[model samples]
Target: MAHLSLSWANVAIVLSLCLGSISYGYDFSIISTTVGQPTWYAYMGLTTDPTQASLYSYSNSIIGTIFGLFSAGAIFGGLFVGWFSDAHGRKKSLLSAAVINIVGGALQAGSVHVGMFIVARFITGFAAAMLVALVPVYIAEVAPPAIRGLLVGQHGAFFLVGYTVAAWVAVGSFYSANASFNWRFPLSLQALWPLLLCFFVYWLPESPRWLVSKGRPDEAWKILAKLHYDPKDPEQLFAREEFFQITSQCAADKASYGDVSLLHLFTKPHLRKRTLVATLVMWASPANGAIVIYSNIVVLVAGLGFDSADSLLLSAGWITLACVGNFANAFYLDKLGRVRSMVIGYVGCIVFVIIEAAIVAEYGGTTNKAALSAGVAMLFGFITFYGGFVDTTIYVYCSEIFPTHVRAKGMGWSIAVFFLGNLPFLESSTTGYATIGWKYYLLFIILPALNVGLLIYFCPETKGLSLEEINGIFEDKVAVRLTNLTEEERRDLDSRILDGVVGKDPQAQAPERNNVEKSAEVTLDE
Candidate 1:
């Protein structure tokens, strides 16, 4: 029942890294508002119907292209970071991505034509992808295992804040009435978050796990000391034990795998399973139509016969509720196992979206106020479940699944798959919403149901274990060395190898032992 207590330094790391996710959220959600604006349509010359002056009036193709291209750029950006972070380091990759976003944001705000704007959006998408890919990896590496889920859950919480702010900003922008400043000003705010990140991120500590992977254990040890050692603990027991595990594991992994290539992620049986599970986890998290729902929410609400002002307000409320859901996720993510929490989120989304679809099918464009209210409520419920149950767990699962040797690359592959996964959902939204209407949500419902099944079988529960000890889930019960140990030696080795200075909980130890036994049995059968 007790939550992990954080030191001030721990608070600073979580705040800094998690805050970086806000930029992506703001830029990503800001488009929802901008594209809904009449001024945005006019500025882009897509307002063909002057009679529909208050609406976007752009064709499905145009809307699809604008949204789809961002995913395309994100796919590219995600792949690039895998190699870049592994080659350089986590801190440098983040700073570089922030710089790229600044350039892209400037271009977006100052654009004179639609072509110019599209290119700028792609650049920004590219930059934002890097932040999404690397930030979770940084968080997972930096946080203590006891509280890792809570720390990583902050990524989703901060992301919802960005989405909420953008929705309200769009509501405020609507009052301006002037075509030029209305859309341009909101576009310009995208630059502010990355700029703040650039200034402060460089000064924070790099991931000690990453440093150890690069054969710089001395520097890694110093950082681990700073991060984990409390002067109040006279023995320095926890920090020393943790440091030893990290160094020992790095040595063991190097010996086992030799030099790591990305190919090893697929070539080794256990590593391949980790890679697949991690990538699939990323794909499933967003499968519940989060991007589709949020991106086109204003248009969907308007299509339900609400006025532009009311639609914007309604979308803002829906997103605000989602923000609250994410905060709840941050609090209880550690208490609920990752597999259970994610299942709850996915199932919640499926139920809500099905209800929304039914209501919209029955009552859309009608004067049935009750049906309209229910539909709006259903959409809000969808986001609430999506943000809390699904979105919150994606990064935490993906980041924790990989060892340090392949951590960044592993994260990149998963995120790249994430963006690529978005392509089908995002591309379908504009045309699907314009044509099939509420039935469009059926797609979101079906895919996530399948994902839930996939997770139930493959995803391991990763609560309350150190990063080093987590490898036991994948490693052999016996070490891979040529020498054999006596029964007494084996028990001592198991205690040291499986549990560190902090004694293991029976609850955690039981599942972990099962995981190791199951993995070894499976390998033997193979």
Candidate 2:
């Protein structure tokens, strides 16, 4: 991996953006917990209980609409973010997501009818997906290569936190004395992260890469210095090298792709490959049983004969386990590398989901405590492992691959695919469990099984490279092996690149692809 100092400037940015991620979680997932509550039943006029104290059986379509519409809106939000973030700028796009989130959150809290609630779900989904999709792009831009996964994956970790909050809020709403306050308060909680984002919007530094692409190298340089600063080195060697690399590569990118278009993703062969990688990764994002567990586990546990209250609480614990897994992902993600971790996550999901389906098939609707206990235990274990391997894998991997020119758009399109992917799971869950029972999970087994093959073929390892350097991988060009170089070697290489005209200018044409990869291969193995 490339060497860059992990400094306080970078840490602060990670912490701040975590709030946006948590907010994204609230809307992305809270629907699961929200719809489970009795107050929600009464509030939506599904139950006649005036005090909003009883739950009722809403048809599959209604429940599906609640979950499906949010994702439907999320698909639009993720697609819009590409143009919105690029045309308006990162900071403004973030603010736009926050403000819109607030409107959706507020309306959800005040919704008087199911129609109003459904509309709010769509509106809320739009902003939440926007926030989650863009946070990785911003974080990846500012992060040092050494700890890039740790920072970029924060949204996934804290997103689990938001989901955990939803679980707890659902538990609390179940017991609240006031009916309206119970569901209303929990629904309104979706605004917390966005509200904090609105308050702190001024504090966000613009993405340095976004700045450079928009023709402001000076600002990008300062942001890089502040983020990757090293007090011990007065020369700011690593930081300076990064600036040169970013500006040089971005210039090359501009020269190559004039006026980047969304169509370029499919039309240009190089970008088409990159697009295929991102789409495949994201298309599989909602593929496995992970989303099924997130959205419908409480219902599953309830089927195991745990009453509504205990079911919600256990679901909360399950989300907490997922959060722990996300933390674990940050610690070792770069070490395992994205492709391996992703494969492991998918394969692991296959094993545990198979066990869970069998358990649900045999023990569901029964008071067989021991079998139910085993079933629940397997489900929880599956989530923890799933979280560790997959939570941030798709977003971090996809965001890191694209050049600055279409990064936002690529991510937007990628995230949109993710939400669109959710439609299948949500739509199926609505009717599958009621009709096929455990067989629905059997359908999930196939996608991840297929994805393992797709991932190994389409994705390349990008563990230790700057965003600028990542360009070479897709183009079959190896620009630089900055990670394997020692400090003095890097300084010397930096000097060589600076005295440009004597050789192939690093700014104009990158070094030949095969030579650098062959050399770096030996160093990487060691």
Candidate 3:
């Protein structure tokens, strides 16, 4: 839709859907914090002082195992959800995740042993992974192309809202007189978000694209118009055009590939390339090396020579700042376009990481206050830029890259790889900071440097185009991207397709369509 204004109804829909993200975020922050509680250590027969968690060998084993198990669970969860979301439908998949998380959260809160708690963590990871991977697909399907970035980017911002809240609440529990309350109370809070989602999820609209794929075009048309309705444009021309685009493209997609199968993601030449780009981009999203900082922010803050009392407060504030940065990203993202925003993120990551390595290498062991201060500022800068540019853009970019038929499966694989991308940086120990020092930062620079090259040649601009329009770009069905064209140009292109598309049998055009189309790779320059 050209020059569309966001309706209040659409904004409400976006906000309501973000509860799943908030749950995913809260679970993420709560896990990292609850693992550090004194009672948690006691339960595991380890040191009460979490600061010594690393110093103690058994504590290191369990803590590392916990993180590893969570990653494993998340990977499997991603693979499962792709098939589930596509087969059942988007809203059902979301609700299933919420229900699963409710069970996982309760398991986590009331665990009687370390094994149960470990199981609980795995379950929570499974459900949380589904939530994150699926939310963007549903939102992208329904969001107006004009503000698609701004709408879909809310997943990043809202999850961080949960992250920020979990941070402050963990701080509150840390100071509580009751020891078990420190871990149990915060872990129990995980149930709250999914419970909220379960209560309100019925209000959400199903993805119109999914409906069309299911042979429900009349329903899809009504929902699409409602989603993109502009009161000023009473005729809803954009909405009608958008519905036409999705249905026709999906018709062609069905003709090209008989049914949705995981094998198609690997076997189809065009799909294989998309899957590769999505996977690499997802990998690149976490390769920026901010995981080291996020997992150790309180320690990093404390190391800046601040009093212990203020470290947690400052950590919470930093996450909140990152949350704000995500909101800023939501707004600026469409204006910059997905590929450029990601490149800016990669280039910025390389720049700040280099500066950070230099600062730490120069004065890491020294009590030189100015140098310490500069190093701390650089860490904050790196995270803020990464959160705004890279972290926030991953979902928006990946969700739009595939056609409606395979988007869920594509995202599942992408998010699964995303979990793997994070593994290399989970060093979670200051041993690297102290033993390897600045050289550890140097390790992170390589992938993002490689990523900028991958992005320039592999990723294309998807901003300001409908989801079906983007599929056309990948298939080489259009010579010029509609996003870069004038209204007249789009009208001309639409008129040709509209003749065969509007109120006609899609199969009738299949033979002629097959003769002209090519499944070539698309790039920024192409």
lDDT score of model 1?
0.78
The CA lDDT of each predicted structure is 0.78, 0.80, 0.77
Q: Rank the candidates by lDDT, best first.
A: 2, 1, 3
lDDT of candidate 1 over 1-526, digit per residue (tens): 0123356777788788765788888878888898778788867778524376345335556677778888888989988998899899999999999999888888888999888888888998898889988888898887877788888888878888888988998899888957788888888888899899987897788888888677666677677667775767544444545555565566566656655677788999878989889888988855878888889989888777788889999999988988898888878888897899899989998998889889988998799887888888888888878787778788888888787788888888888888888888887787787668778888888999999999999888878866666676765221222113466754564456437522332223333333443454455556
Model 3 Cα lDDT, one tens digit per residue, 328-422: 88889989888888888778778888987898778876888898778777877887788878777988999989888899999998888987776
What's model 3's TM-score? Answer: 0.88
Off by over 4 Å in 1: 1-5, 48-58, 476-526
Q: Could you estimate the TM-score for every candidate?
A: 0.88, 0.91, 0.88
Greater lDDT among 1 and 2 belongs to 2
Cα miss at 276, model 1 (Å)? 1.4
Q: Where does the lowest 10-residue lDDT sum fall in candidate 3?
A: 516-525
Each prediction's Cα RMSD? 7.2, 6.6, 5.3
Clashing pairs in 2: none
User: Best-fitting candidate, measured by lDDT?
Assistant: 2
Best model number under TM-score: 2
